[model samples]
Target: MLDLWFSEFHAPDAKLSILVKEQLYSEQTPFQKIDFFDSETFGKFFTLDGLIMITEKDEFIYHEMISNVPMAVNPDIKKVLIIGGGDGGTAREVCRFKTVEQVDMVEIDERVVRLCQKYFPQTACALDNDPRINLIFGDGLKFVQDAPEGAYDLILVDSTDPLGPGEGLFTTEFYRNCYRALNDKGILINQHESPYYKEYAYEMRRAHKKLASVFSIATVYQFYMPTYSSGHWLFGFASKGLDPVKDADFKRWSEFGLQNRYYNPGVHLGAFALPNYVQEELQKED
Candidate 1:
C-alpha cells in the first residue's frame, strides 16, 4: 500500500484524537498534550512518540546537530549512512556538508517518509532533489549487517528514543554492526537517552560500555531537546582510531556557507564536553 493512502485517510483527525485524548502510553513520552500543531507550509506538525520534531517549518536544529557534528569532526567524511531518519530531516542536514559525497537513508517506515515528504516539504527538500542521497525503505539493523564492512566514512543513527519500535537500535549487536560498517577511521554518532532521567542515563551507560570495546574512541555528548521531560539529551560517538572528540576538523562554522541557530564551531566543541557525573557513569567499564 502506498503511504499516501494512509496519510490521506488519517489526515488531521488522528492528530485531533491525540490532542483530545492526552493519554500518553508508557512507551511514549509526551512532549506536549497538544504536540501536534498546524503549520502554514506543512499543514500539521505531528510529534511522533514525543521525542522527534516532525514539522515543515523548523526541523533544522535536530538534523543539524546529528549530522553536522560528526561531519565537522571528521572533515574527510565522504560516504555516510543514516539509520531510521524516515522524516528526512537528517538527510537535509547531511547534504549541507560540501565534503560529503554520498548519503544512504535506511528507514523502516515508508508511511512516515511519504507523510513527511507530503507535509514537511522543507525538511524533505534535499531528499527529493539531491543526487547524492539513496533512500532505502527497509530495516536498518539488517541492512547494516548485510552491508560490506568499511563502506561508510560516517554513520549517523537518527532514530527515536529506545521506547518501542526504536529499542533494538540501541543494543550492543546494532553497535557492533555499526562498528563493522565503518571504515578504519569512520565515525558513528547515535542519539543517547537523557541524562537527567536515571534509567536513560543508565541505558546510555550500558550502550557506551558496549561501544567502547569495539571502537578505539567512545564518548557521549549533551544537548538540550526542550520537548523532552529532562530537557537534555546524550549522543554517543565511537570511532575505530579517530578519537571522536579530539579529531574535530572544524575550521569554522561558515565552512558550509549556511545559516544555523544552535551550532557554531564553539557550540560544536562545547556540546561534547560533558559534566562530572555523566562522565563518571557513562565511562564506567562493565
Candidate 2:
C-alpha cells in the first residue's frame, strides 16, 4: 500500500499534513507555483508557492466573512474593488448583493484565475458570469495608486501573505492609496494575517497599525479557518466614517435574504469583540 500526503509548514515547529487521494494539476506560473489536489476531507483544494490557499469543504467561511462583514455594515454599497482575489470566491460572495452595481477585481497572476476557473469552478464561478465584475490581471498596489479619489464604496483585499507577489500590498503607501481611493463613507477590508502564531502576529500588528494610521475608523475582526497558519484568523476593517460595529445594518442586511454558512448578524457583532490578547497585540509597536 502507498500513502500520499501534502504538507505545509506554518513555522519552524508547526506543520499541517493532509492525506491526498490524487494530485490533479501542478504548474509554475510567472508569479508563483500553483497546485491542485483531491482529498477525502477537503475535496478539491489548491495551493500557491507551497502554501494552502483554499479547500472546498471550508472555503465558504473565508469568502463569506470577508465579503459580508463590510457589506452588512453598509448595505447600500454599490461599487467595490477586490484586490488579489484571483480565485473569484470574494467576487462570488460580493455579487450576491443585488444592491451592488459594479465590482473590479485585480490579481497579480492571471494564471491563478485561469487555472482556478478550469480546475476549481466552485470558487471561480463568478469571474465570467457576473456582468458587474471587471476582471483585471494587474498589480493591486498600482491599481489603488492610480484609482481616482473616492472611486469605490468598498475594497476587499483578499490577498496572499505579505510575501512574494503580495508583499507590496502590505506597504504604508498602499494603505494610504487605499484610503485615498475610497469614498467619504467607503470601507476597506483586508486579510489581517493571524495572531495565534508569533510569526503571523507581527504581520497582524503591522497591518493593523498601518491601516489604523490611514483610516479614521479601523479595527480587526476574527474568524476561524481550519487550514490556514492557525485556526484563528483575522481581517482588518477600515473606513472613512463607518464604525463596523456601530454602523452595522443587521436588520437591513437580513433583508437581503442571503443565507450563509458562517456569517450572521450575531456573528458579525461578536467577530469584532477581539480576544484580550489580540487586542493587546494590535496595540503593541511592531
The lDDT for every candidate, in the order shown, is 0.72, 0.93
lDDT of 1 by residue, 112-183 (tens): 676667666777788889999999988898999998989999999987767666777888899889989999
Q: What TM-score number comes out for model 1?
A: 0.81
Best by TM-score: 2
Q: List the residue pairs that clash in candidate 1.
A: none
Measured with C-alpha atoms, the lDDT of residue 122 in candidate 2 is: 88
Model 2: residues with Cα > 4 Å off, grouped in runs: none
Q: CA lDDT of 34 in candidate 1? A: 19
**Quality of model 2 by C-alpha lDDT:** 0.93
lDDT for model 1: 0.72
User: Across residues 91-146, which tens digit of lDDT does each residue of candidate 2 receive?
Assistant: 99999999999999999999999999998898999998999999998999999999
